[model samples]
Target chain A: MTTASQLTPRRQATRARLLTAAAEVFAERGFHGASVEDICEPAGFTRGAFYSNFASKDELVIELYAEHAASLRQAIAEVAAQPGLTLPDLLERVVDIWTRDPDERRRWYLLTTEFALHAVRDDDARRAWQRLQSQIRKELGALIESIAARHDLELAVPTSDLVRLLTIVLQGGLGQHLLEPRAVRAGALEREFLPLLVEATTR
Target chain B: MTTASQLTPRRQATRARLLTAAAEVFAERGFHGASVEDICEPAGFTRGAFYSNFASKDELVIELYAEHAASLRQAIAEVAAQPGLTLPDLLERVVDIWTRDPDERRRWYLLTTEFALHAVRDDDARRAWQRLQSQIRKELGALIESIAARHDLELAVPTSDLVRLLTIVLQGGLGQHLLEPRAVRAGALEREFLPLLVEATTR
Candidate 1:
């Protein structure tokens, strides 16, 4: 609930550093392996500082997921706003944004997936993560709606269903790319198949 | 490589029990937590019998993966061979097989995913798993090819790409289903979208 903008400049900087340190530590040591002290030491902040910025490691990860999701959503929205582009073009641009971040993108996904496995068994953690995810689903639904309206196409399925399929494609591509990069190049699966989905599932 | 038929009936029964026990043990305790003894205890076998059938835990998981993949492949292949079924009919049947086998299906996916997390970090483990996966890919490719040929449609992408996309859809549905069952029904994503992929990607 506390936004970075609500904090003073120094606290905001501290929070950013802690998030960065958490990303690195979590990526290397995994969710359960990385302790608060481990994350605090690298961020050059004490436990008190970490507590001030984030309530717990779970909160920190949820924020990271929100940040990652927001950046991707914003990037795609910018592309969608471009005048005269088709739905496929907008999708391709979205894939580009997804794959373009290189190291950070890979690290975020690594941390996200590692945490997802942990969260699946933990009720509070899953609920917190899902809250953010539902917001994401709504935004994506609106985006798909706008694109469909622009193209004058009546969708074969509901907007939410299409969003779910897009979600599946995105996560599917990420999972495959993470496990077998050579087999599934960064964005290759989404790029080739998502457009086909739009074409086949819409009139 | 050793088929059940190659073993004596007693050995085959032992191997099957060990596998079933491994599924339960691994599901309860993950890849590293579950010991060979734990698997053996439930199967009513000693660690010696475990070693005779599987070289190690990794081998056991790979074999489990192989078995699960083979059963699904065989089931889908049977559906494909049914006379006069269209591509959508075959796909629906495939989804049914995936969603059916309720208890075993859920357990196998849980074990497989846990092993996958472990395998992602271990090269020897990954390579062993990939060897079986590449086989699945080939089989899926041929299945897609046959269904397309049956429909007399020219595929927009290569059979292999469609297979990869389908693979993405399956895992995407699975990962979501595992994490949030109410949000993504067992076979909902694959059922609605896979046929759309086939319809749109083939001419």
Candidate 2:
């Protein structure tokens, strides 16, 4: 096996390009609609390059989810590390990160729903999907715990319950917004619901 | 055009069978995966019968949404007509109607998500979908208004906003449950969040 240092910068750049291209193709055409050739063409790479980078399209999807989860955790960590950030302020920042662009937001929602349907149909995919979900939940639980400690507030519900509630609100809110943008505006959850949840949980 | 009375009972039964079969087939095979032939085979009908009832698969999907919405309205009306139901009690009953059967729940969720992704790609479908959504929201708003009046309670938010919040919570909650059933159990939203919302909105 080649060591990380042994991989050339050019190969690393090609891998990154392939991943980005895959996200675009999958979002636009869906997993079944999109093909390996479609991803390779836009990335200016060949089938051989894509094959070398990813074992299959499913692997790329798993990687995409992993990357998204990691970035989310990083953003949460950065926000948590800030000094004296109020709960509402932290929530606003997090919501801003998640709901930046309407078009990109729709794309992400479509891709996620597609993956969810896939997970339901395939056992192996469900296992991988659940693993990522569990990781995100754990990280969110930890963040909530730390925030509660800093504010000298006791959560009215379990940390896991609170995290699950937030997850439902965020995912469900995104689906509504995508379906009816005017009615369910972006950041509606953070603006209208998150504050209520925070208030309800705090002693 | 044939008059409604002129249609035989057998004809009416066939149409109903086609609709029910269409729902099951669409949920199991998805919109694109399913065909008129597949729907007819299971319903013990022919492609001709399916065509006589629905213009196409798209039409069947639209009709399915309409039937679901109508049943939901009827349920709400029945619950509202009850003599001594408090807002919390009304909410619990509504939630119960919506969350009664896990298998049926999974099918509805899958069908809704499938239609949502379709709406993203098709403008005509989106328009049809939004019309149904608007109707549902209007009915929900009216229900909230009537409940508030009966309880002598003042809403802290706009009726529309309250409905939207509830929609986000339910839809988002369903998506989370689909992904990780163990973590987000069935009826968790009604059990935990709905009571909090009713309390928040009440005096």
Q: Can you list each candidate's DockQ? A: 0.55, 0.55
For model 1 chain B, the run of ten residues with the poorest summed lDDT: B101-110
Model 1 vs. true fold: TM: 0.89
In terms of TM-score, which candidate is strongest?
1
lDDT of each: 0.80, 0.77
Fnat measured on candidate 2: 0.58
Tens digit per residue, CA lDDT, model 1, A1-203: 57777889988888788888898898888777899999989667899988978888999998888877877887787888899997777888888888887677666766777677766767888887777778878988887788788889888898877887787788767767767878878999888887788888788
In model 1, the runs with Cα more than 4 Å from the true position are A5-10, A84-86, B1-11, B44-46
Residue A121 of model 2 has an lDDT of 69
Q: Estimate TM-scores for all models.
A: 0.89, 0.85
| Angstrom error at residue A119, model 1 | 2.9
